[model samples]
Structure formats: C-alpha cells, structure tokens
Target: MYKINDFSRLSETQAAYSAGNTNLLLYDLPQHYSDEYRSYDSPRLCTIINGAKEISVNQSEHFVYKKDKFVLLPPNSTVHMYLPEHTKALVYEFGDQLIDNVRQRVSDKLNIDISKNDSHETFMQDTLTQRIDALNRRIQEIVLENDVNMSFLIDLTCQEMVYELLKIKGSYDIIYHHQ
Candidate 1:
C-alpha cells in the first residue's frame, strides 16, 4: 500500500501543499515513469494537464489523454499508472477525515445518508474534465496568490468539487450510497 500521509511525512523533496485538510500534488515528469500497483488510503482526484498516461485498475487498462480526461480513485483501491515523457498532472489527495466531513455536510444539507458503497473503483469521466481543469487552474491561482486565508479558499473549492461530482449520475456512487 502507498500511504500518502506517510509519503508526505517522510519525503522532503516532493513539493506538496496543504490547504485546509486537502493535500495537493503537482507532478511534472520529464521521462517515462511507471508506478507499480499500490493502494491509496485516501481518495484521489487526478487531472492530466499535459501528455498521456496509462492507468490500470482491477486489470482494466485505460489510456488517458491530456487536458481531456480526469480520474477519480476511490479509497483503498489499487492502481498502476505510467506517465510518458513531458507529462504534467495535478493530483488532489483527500484524507479520510476530510471526505467524512464533506459527506456529513452534504448529507445534512440534502437530508440524505451518505454512506460508503461496496464498490471500490477508478472512474474516468470525460464530461467532468472541463470542470476539473477549471478547478485546477483556480487552485493554482489561489496558491500563487498566497492569501492569508488560502487554506479556507482551497477547502471551499474542494467542497465545491465534491458537490459537483455528486451531481453526476454514476460518479455519485463513488463517494456514497443512497439509503
């Protein structure tokens, strides 16, 4: 298992930012890089800004093109990913606590139960790619601005993303199962 929290704690070289409860990772690869199958303890939303990648989840392989695709990896799911040269990507890592908090907030707002589903899958949604792209740009802008309440803005943006994802049909089940 690839524990993101452990990686965050142990690695001083990897440039990562913390906003509220979210961890942001910007990966810029110059050459071929392959990541072996590993399970993430938290959920991840990845957007490919440039280049292409091959991702394998549960023996299903997917080719993700740049600027037109986004992947959502559920917690505790194993995945293999390969990035070709000149690949740039933004990955947002959401802690379990953050997800729980969001779930509660959404559930309370909508008056519904947001419980976990049995399905642990990786979703590639092209329809959400544009929104993800816009969100990524906004995040970069806020990070560069370095405002006093940067964390708050980032957290709010992340919450917006979660709500948007929930609006999508199939993607809803990725985070919660309706009761």
Candidate 2:
C-alpha cells in the first residue's frame, strides 16, 4: 500500500525453493522513505542500487543505498525501509533456503570449488543492474497504464527479472553455506 515501487511486479516463479516448496510472489512496493515497519510473516531482501533507503529492524535503523548494498529481512521482522526522494531500489521476498538455489548454480557455472565466502552475497550485482531496471520499468509501465494485460505480463516479466538476478548471484547453487 506504500509508494515503494514504481512498477507492477507479477511473477509465476518461486523466489525461494526449498525441497521443491516455492513461495509465490509478484510484489512491487511503492516508493517509501518511511519509518520502521515490520514483516511478521514473510522475509524480505533489499537489493538497493541507486536510491537511498533507511531501514529499521527491531526498532533500530540502518541506511543503505548503493550498488554494493543488500540486506536480508528475517521472517516476522519488525523492520521498515525508507527510500528517499528520487531514489530507486529492488526488493525480493525470500523464505526457506534460497541460498541453496544460488549455490547450486554458481558452482556449476564458475566451475570452482567455491563455498559462500561471505563475499558472494553481492556477487555480480552490477552486471545485473540493467536487467533489474528493465524489469522494474516493465512493471511500472503496466501499473501506470492500469492495464488488465498486466496480469500476464507482470508474471513473465518479474520471473525473468528475478531469474536474471539469481543468475548474477549464481542462483541457489552458489550463495548458501552450511555454517
């Protein structure tokens, strides 16, 4: 209900896949520069690339907005993210163990005997910026038009965008660790 996203997010893909269980979502939040809020049900991930965002968790706030910024929102998280004027950000709903998904793909793609070394969280994000923006724009176009066509388009577009993001992060194959 907040002005957190400029686009409409509709997707048929599961943002997280755990033992085959998938969480379905195609959410596009409005632009927000608000105070602390909470997600007592679902977990969220903020991948901020352009705009300025101030987020609060358990009543504590943190500012993040840059090509290198990303945050993990734990389930039932009493958190809020604030997006400043003229700001842009990307948010992902994550639950279960989506890191498995990233780790699997990264291992296969890079052919490295690599584990999530703490540096992998923000891997290749700059490479995915264009794709992320494109997806955001696509959703925005549909939302602004108030087009019923958004239903189908949003589903595909969001999935593609999310997929691209997973690819850049190396999917479930490369991001998770046992520790």
- Please list the C-alpha lDDT of all candidates, in the order they appear: 0.64, 0.45
Model 1's alpha-carbon lDDT is 0.64
- For model 2, what is the C-alpha lDDT against the true structure? 0.45
TM-score of every model?
Answer: 0.76, 0.47
* Candidate 2 C-alpha lDDT tens digits along 2-49: 233322122223332121222323334345546444443434445544
Please provide, for model 1 over 1-179, each residue's C-alpha lDDT reduced to its tens digit, 9 standing for 90 to 100. Answer: 11132223344125667776687776666556776534355566777667877777656766655667677766666666676666777778765566667667776665444345565564545545467668878887887798988889989888877766655555656554321
**TM-score (C-alpha, index-matched) for candidate 2:** 0.47
How far is 116's C-alpha from truth in model 1 (Å)? 7.2
Candidate closest to the true structure, highest lDDT: 1
TM-score, model 1 to reference? 0.76
